[model samples]
Target: MLPVDTTQLLKGVLDLAVLAVLRDEDGYGYDILRRLRTSGLTEVGDASVYGTLRRLFNAGLLSTYVVPSVEGPHRKYYALNAAGRGELQRSGKIWQDFASTMDDLLRERETA
Candidate 1:
């Protein structure tokens, strides 16, 4: 069997992952990327997370604000709006269902 490309899998679920992270609190681009890595998605890239934040904001699912930083430059934070929350819930359900199906399939193969 061939090894699974985690990067490819990350691409398929990057948006969902980003949304999930933002569900608890708002964060800047780099901070969001760090959260994903800390959550075991070390394969996630900076550009990908930043791009996802931009795309999500443009899609009307996220809101952004600028916060002045004492050390460096101002940070732009992203937060989920009503639409974003709705998308997160809907997407989460879809992911759960798909994951469950895949688990069942793998378990069957293991038993067989």
Candidate 2:
């Protein structure tokens, strides 16, 4: 299969992705980045994740706190607030619907 431009696709879904990660547990910037990679989003970058965290926090969808770290400076952890959780649920549903439709179309094309 041809490679897809995941970066372009990720632009619109970054919020949902970040919120989804925070939905389960809080994480610092690097920790969140690692989680994205672990979740199969290998093309995701550190800068993009950091920016999304800032935007989500500014939009009041996420909350943040600092925890002291022995390895280095204090870590800023992010968690999904009620608003973030709501957005995650709504966006996940929309994505699921869109993906299902795309899958149906692809199947029809293959059969034709």
Overall lDDT per candidate, in order of appearance: 0.95, 0.92
Model 2: how far residue 70 lies from native, Å: 2.5
Pick by lDDT: which candidate is best?
A: 1
Instruction: State the local distance difference test value for candidate 2.
Output: 0.92
Tens digits of per-residue lDDT, candidate 1, 1-112, equal 9999999999989999999999999999998999999999998988899999999999999999999999999999999999999999999999999999999999999999
Q: State TM-scores per candidate.
A: 0.98, 0.94
Q: Model 2, 2-80: lDDT tens per residue? A: 7888899998788888898888899999999999889998999889999999999999999999999899899999999
The lDDT, on a scale of 0 to 1, for candidate 1 is 0.95
Assess the local accuracy of residue 48 in candidate 2 as a C-alpha lDDT between 0 and 100. 93
- Colliding pairs, model 1: none
How many residue pairs clash in each candidate at the backbone level? 0, 0
